[model samples]
Target chain A: MQKDASLTTPAAIRKLVRAGDYSGHTSGFAPGFVQANLVILPKQYAFDFLQFSQANPKSCPIIATSHSPGVTDMPTVGEDIDIRSDLPRYRIFKNGQMVEEVTDISDVWRDDLVTFLIGCSFSFEEALIAAGLEIRNITEHKNVPMYVTNMPCQSAGMFHANMVVSMRPMKPADAIRAIQVCSRFPSVHGAPVHFGDPAAIGIKNINKPEFGDAVTIKNGEVPVFWACGVTPQIAIANAAPDFCITHSPGHMLITDIPNSRMAAL
Target chain B: MQKDASLTTPAAIRKLVRAGDYSGHTSGFAPGFVQANLVILPKQYAFDFLQFSQANPKSCPIIATSHSPGVTDMPTVGEDIDIRSDLPRYRIFKNGQMVEEVTDISDVWRDDLVTFLIGCSFSFEEALIAAGLEIRNITEHKNVPMYVTNMPCQSAGMFHANMVVSMRPMKPADAIRAIQVCSRFPSVHGAPVHFGDPAAIGIKNINKPEFGDAVTIKNGEVPVFWACGVTPQIAIANAAPDFCITHSPGHMLITDIPNSRMAAL
Candidate 1:
């Protein structure tokens, strides 16, 4: 799908996604808006999931949850949003494996479902870019390389998984600036968890990532890693709930909240 | 030579230093209070010196300046503060070279002198310590290591010199937390300029520092550097005006203002 010039605001973009037409990566789609990672589970698992997010805020920062399961008017994040079908794409899972992919889930929407919007890296990436720091993945025109780390999440109920991290290579100066800029948005994976010597965090090879494409790390540049939104997905898969759904990688749910609105400073 | 119990408050400490009895390192003295770096110059160099501080704020963050030349009291930072004798020790310089070291400058106090209080690292180090981060220098019982860097300060009139930085080693996670904690005290150097590599910032050897004793860098820890208050002193020494007086290393002006008062958050 090419760029949809008509989809200017997040509402317009969501309207298109709801109408079953636009299903592509949401990057560069909504310029100043907050893009979130989506997770849908049965209401029975809601409390445990919320606990999981609170315990590991860096990996799974819960921005907004459904007011009550089944009703989806998130006035705080959007003007007229529907959790069931407002995202560009979603992956459906059954017993720990991805079963199918879809643009909208209105047909499968259920009253027992609870929607969670986890803060995405797009928000912090936008901040870093605005600060004049170059993002390695964006410059290389490749997916951000992600790795599974040795760090374990504080398990909640049946959910248990190791952390997944996204890598960005930068000079020490740029990395320092990035940490300051990213610190403001705690909801968006505030600050890097680790940098330099990938082996320190159990990343055996810098070039071969478990997910996304590897970007260039120059001589002076070190690989800075952030707690990834994908960690919850890994957790969900490990738990292997009977049914699960999450936004397809890079296809986020763009909300009305401006990126600047997320800054704690 | 030892922690003085009688010097309980900034006023009491000032009185002792004023009476020529307590002349020693101000660290851990008057706990929870602000200990400031003192810089006094001839009136001819005040405006340009202030401009230099304003330009290179990270390297030379000026918290307060004398209301006007010839004034001895700085009520903004402390009440009944006698600038001429409050600090434990003063270094008198003639044409950029140290001419004498004295406990008090009242004998040579001039009407054409202006004083400035630069924020000290002790403020943020206290905060980091409170947060359970180990300051390597304090842990090793040595002065924080300092080095002259190739990064140049923005010159103002006759004031000009390369920036000097202080180094502390920490694991990557601890370094991230330190960044967040130090960010709240922008008056005290704000965030670090660089990390990971020493040569990138023009430091030839980590162990062989220009000022202060070296601390241990553990197997997994990396040295984190901050914009040292020494930069302004270096700039002043390079400028080589007719006369100047500054606090001796570790001899600071104990202010009534609490360390909590300096937090910008």
Candidate 2:
């Protein structure tokens, strides 16, 4: 919680991360701001990966991307969100295997790398909570349950995988309200992809999730599932890109853009 | 289908209805125009009813209201929509008892009357259908099944009733898409209030709807329920005002406003 001005502002948080003082997840650090999933790859695979994101928007909503290879500063999303070090934690991968976890990517930075900032669920979750809908995972203090689904993603070149989804249990009425609230933020997964029967999308057990801790599903509540940011990661790994870098799970690139700025309405 | 120009233009449809040539339900006429639920009340009850609409916006989304008592021509919604004769069918009620249904209300029109144009579901249904989601009621060629819910509406002075909801059957994915599409048209019912178990909303039997014919719920489909336009009528009936009128069910006032005009985005 090194939140000083850093806790309140995106640029300040990046400053702290750049100074090697913090290496933690960015959730709850800056209210009302956009937090993005970071993906970096050599320019060779950038074109195909961009196509994959554009083709499957709900799972991989692109907020901003580097205008050209080797550009480290994303001035559009934030004043100076240096891709090499702004994120507190980075995962380096080689040929699809995660090779190292580091506080900053400055040492691993390459001129041929292109960075992508994909919309994260934090934006929509903020929206739903603001609308007075109780988010079960937030209430239970756990990562929203994420599951791999039978629903396949449209592949682009070598990248291919099934769509992944994050689930939140809500009463039917609250779920409806959540849908309306989330729809406004199209960049942040928009509305849910599915709800009701989990097995319909190939989830076998409700209590256990593949990627995150499970929350209590109260009686009479149905699980609502949204396209998860993890879908692209899985697709990238399956592609076995020779070199890649990404923010560690929950440790996102905080941006100056407000969540409301992404709303369609 | 006296369409031609009249079939496509809302004002032209009003002209036909005014001349006593068309007196049927307005469905499928003026394809992309907005159709409104009509409610007329004496000046004395206007304040209370307006309060009711304000308090319960989801159920009673008031698109426009009479600027002043005795002004029948609503220039805002259309060029020349005469509340007295524009709608194909008008129901005359005295102390909450329906007296007669007629093509023209010119004879019964009162100088003290104020008209309210409420958003109808037709707008969102068009949007959903355009998005390729099946509306079960339309496929079944039946009125949307409506249920009386135990969910109580906020009451205004001399007006009170439990919320009434119209049900639509859709597969969960389609229902989620419907919610997003409908959310853009807040002037209509907006998003569904509930989906999944009917018992949650106090509807004892899903098959036995209180109003409108029941549409079949397929194996994977869930019943998505929206706050209904019928709500105002129930409130009006509870109020039991001495003089009142409403458009006969499905016989709406076709407005010059295009359906696309209602999208909040």
Candidate 3:
């Protein structure tokens, strides 16, 4: 492990992760900074995914995409971001099926590969915590409960999926406050897609989540849901492109931007 | 009605209202402009109300307030907006009870009066309508149904009340689109407070509203409720100051600012 792995700066963490020393979840590593979900695609599908993200911002809010295809460093998000190696792990998909997990993709890096950095929930979760709201998943030390809802993302080109939402159990008042706070950060799955009843969005059971671990639900708390960045992952999986790459779940690219900067206000 | 009653700009409308000529609801008059919910109080109560608004932005979003006590105009929201008579009507409250509904309050105007202009849902409703979402009340030509919710507004000093929400029914898809559209306009009661079950928010009867006329909830439509400007009225009524004035229900003060200007994005 690198000496600076514990440091909260995105550059230091990316350096440690890039050197093949740390390949684990980036959660809790870089507090107060924006952590992004990574998506690498060929230039051919770039416009379609961009259009898809534009149409469905709540699910796939793009913070910064490569200025042009084959560009490894996104000057806007950080100082030194080598998209091929900065993330702890990458999932290589062949026609939508995960084929391999690697720390470095430099060998397969193509001049036509386009990198997209999406806003992650970590930014807004920090905001919610700052506002004194208890995040159930954080308290339980578990991944947020995620469900595959019947709600469909607006189709753009070939990308489409029933939206995947991450759930946080909160009291109604806390949920209202979360809505106000999260609404200010549109890039990070702004506000919530649904709340109160799971069945309303076609989730049959509250105890069983399709992804992530379920946390304890208190007496007064209702499950508040946000459009997850995972929705695009599911869409990409469904589309089954010839070749694609993504950051492994929970392993995000920590960016130099402060979480406060993500706030649209 | 005067020849330019509908044709007049917000400044002209306020000018006419100031001169004690027009004394009707300001709706449908300023087509592309903003309308405000007026609350004028003594300087002593200003900080508390501002705190209350900051704490509960969804219920009482303060667009522009008197820069200093006794300032008659808010240069940010309009030009020459006289705090006393720009509104079509004003309701005088003593100990929280409405004592008079008058066209003008020049007689009661004091040196210490601090005026607050709150964002009204009319601006966002215009945006929603432009986005092709049907506003039930507008279509039925009735006041939007408003209900007192069990949800409490965060208290600041002496200002607090249960939140009041206005309802508009729409199909699930339209409701989703409305959410996205309203999310862009935070100042104007952005997004629905609660949707689906009114009972969730302590609303007992869908048809029986505490304020405004109840519109039909069509077969496939659900009642989407928004945190209303009326919420502050309830708080003000509960707080019951020695002297208070508000715009009469539906008799808003239209501003020269366009509705699009309120979109935070």
lDDT of each: 0.92, 0.91, 0.88
For candidate 3, the docking band is incorrect
Task: For each candidate in turn, give its C-alpha RMSD to the true structure in angstroms.
Answer: 1.6, 2.5, 5.2
For model 1 the local lDDT of residue B228 reads: 98
Model 1 interface CAPRI class: high
lDDT value, candidate 3, whole model: 0.88
Model 3: per-residue Cα lDDT over A1-265, one tens digit each: 5445456678888888889889988888878999999999999888988899999999999999999989899899999788889999999999999999998999999999999999999999999999999999999999998999999999888898999999998876577668878878999999887776688788999889999998898876778889999999998988888999999999889899999999888
Q: Supply the TM-score for candidate 3.
A: 0.74
Model 1 chain B weakest 10-residue run by lDDT: B1-10
Residue pairs clashing, model 3: none
Question: In candidate 2, what are the lDDT values of residues B130-210, reduced to their tens digit?
Answer: 999888899989999999999999999999989999999899988988888888888998988999999998999999999
What lDDT score goes with residue B83 in model 2?
A: 85
lDDT of 2 by residue, A73-132 (tens): 999999867788888899999999999999888888888999999999999999988899
**2 or 3, greater by DockQ:** 2
**Highest TM-score, which number?**
1
Q: Which ranges of candidate 2 are over 4 A from the true structure?
A: A5-7, A79-82, B1-8, B79-81
Per-residue C-alpha lDDT of model 3 across residues B80-148, encoded as one tens digit per residue: 877777888899988888899998888998889899999998899899989977888999999999999
Better of 1 and 3 by TM-score: 1
